[model samples]
Target: MPRKLLILIADGMGDYPAQELDGRTPLQAARTPNMDAAAAQGTVGTCRTIPSGMPAGSDIANMAIMGYAPKRYHTGRGPIEAAAQGLDCAPSDLIYRLNLCTVSELSPSGLMLDHSGGHIQNEEALNLLQVLRTELDTDQVQIIPGFQYRHLLKHTDGVGTLEAGLDLVPPHDILNTPLAPALEVYARSPLLDSMIHRAHSILTSAWNQTQANAIWPWGQGPPLALPSFAHTFGLRGAVISAVDLIKGLGRAAGMDVLDVPGATGLVDTNYQGKVQAALNFLEHGDFVFVHLEGPDECGHAGDLDCKIQAIERFDEHIVGPVMLDLARMEGAVCMACDHLTPVGVRTHTTEPVPFCFLDSRQIQSGAHEGFSEAAAAAGDVHLEAGHLLLPYLLDRMQEADG
Candidate 1:
């Protein structure tokens, strides 16, 4: 029988111990009976998905998760998001991930009050984007909107000299920090920075403005291309994610890039729809990558309660249902996070995250009580390279037969 593969990724699900929770991480505090069952029956261990020295961004870790070495195939987040937006730019063109940020004031010296602008809704984001395009976009620059506050800033006729090593800070990384320094650093790109300032001025004057008051641009880079997942693994695959970064990665890897309705990439995202999409895709495809962003978002907001609730919801709505269906399959299932978004720093951390692996016919034992960071740390399996774990997962059935 041909073996199937299901990889479920709860983005930024891992975390460090918190004092408020009596030194327990959100995953540890959450009641995840379904994941605990898998841990009890299968193998649980920690996998260092974020390569050493990497920024611990979703773009890097997810590429590694999809079996591409970050050192070789990884590019900046901008290009990946461009791919997700279906934008084809020349090699010399520069792309940056744009966020509709809320600031204390419209000036460059304003503080970054909220990176997500209160998680601005799509309709309002589109309205702001359209206004920016009309007021600020020029022959040299354009703004393309994604879900909520996430968007893209493309330098159509860039001078091709924008180095990837510019010191622009991710807005989310600088919450409550003064934006002047970052703005000054990014302003080195004369044309791009001018457009940014212009957009901010226009945004501040808008009559129907949301909390989103400025455009923050970072994650700049040139174009990127990657080998197809099917060509590399010899199996048809699909990726289901609400975020453009993951969708672009999947598309670049030649995967189906399945879309589910109501996938807002938020705590309120349609968990059931995503699981159903994965299950429906598995009927015809040999591999499926299902990614959830709720936990990550809650982590970024530093809302511990919401993060715990998100994890529990993920287990009940997604994990429990999928595991029940996959039990009858003649394949393997792997559940893991791409990286850790620690609540303390409200940013991604480079620490190794836990992973749970279960083979339908060849279950293991001795896993800890559940699938949390501590449990996985106590287990036996450890994958040094996140990308290499994919083959180890896919070949489990073959290993069982042998």
Candidate 2:
């Protein structure tokens, strides 16, 4: 009998104690009977997905969870996403993750009102990007449209000139903060500064109906290359995600990327579609990574109710159903979050995230009450290096099978 592996990742689902939840994290407060059962009948612990000194972003944490050490393989968030889009780029070309954002003003003292431009609709966002592309597209610079407020910028001539020691901050990190420091950082790159300012001018003048008033670019790097996942792990793997970053990492690792319709990276995402996609992939793949972005987006918005709802939906619509099916077969399931995106901070943090591993063949009598930060910490296992998690789970599954 062949044992399969299923990794369910609720992105940025970990969090600190919140007053709204009466000092309980969203995971603790949410109704997660499926996750609870996994913890109680399996092994629960904490894993530090984000390496020390690394920015607590999904790009780094997810790569670690997928069995690749970020310090060894990570190039940048932009290049990973570029790979997801199947964009060809030279080693010298500079790629950046661009965002259509909303600012209170364009001056130094202006505030970053919305990092996602109020979650601008796709049609409107594409129109804005098209206009910018028409005006700003040059031999050296190009603007590429992505989903919603997320986009991309490529600087074909920025290898030696604009790639060294450049510091561009992620807009989500500076939510509600003054834009002076970020603007100052952008000013370091004359080309980026001019382009950003020109983008603001054009967007405000052309599309005044939407909150997307400016373009912010960060996370620049060269083309990314990674060893094949199948070769590294000896498992045919597939990734199901709504966002490009995860898809990009899967693509870079030579894993099949599965797309589900209506899979918005929001609270209203297609839960059933993702579950179906993961189940279908598992029929032929040895390993399947199912990633949900709703929790992270709600955390970024500082919406406690929405975050809790997202967690519940993940458990009920995805985890519960998938776990039921896997339990009927000889397989193993691991449920975890990439990092902590506390509603209080409204951004990602480098903290150990809770996880539970359940082998259908050998369910253990664990003392864990449910799957939460506190419960997982109370359990016995703890992995300081998150990149080892996949290998650890596989080893445990193999031992159980033997």
Candidate closest to the true structure, highest lDDT = 2
Query: TM-scores of the models, in the given order?
Result: 0.96, 0.98
Instruction: Please provide, for model 2 over 310-393, each residue's C-alpha lDDT reduced to its tens digit, 9 standing for 90 to 100.
Output: 999999998999888987557889999999999999999998999999889878775578899998888788999889999999
Question: Among all windows of ten consecutive residues in candidate 2, which has the lowest summed lDDT?
Answer: 157-166
Lowest summed lDDT window (length 10), candidate 1 = 156-165
- Root-mean-square deviation per candidate: 1.6, 1.1
How well does candidate 1 match the true structure in TM-score terms?
Answer: 0.96
Return the top candidate by TM-score: 2
Q: Sum up the clashes in candidate 2.
A: 0
- For all candidates in order, the CA lDDT equals 0.85, 0.90
Stretches of model 2 off by over 4 angstroms after superposition: none
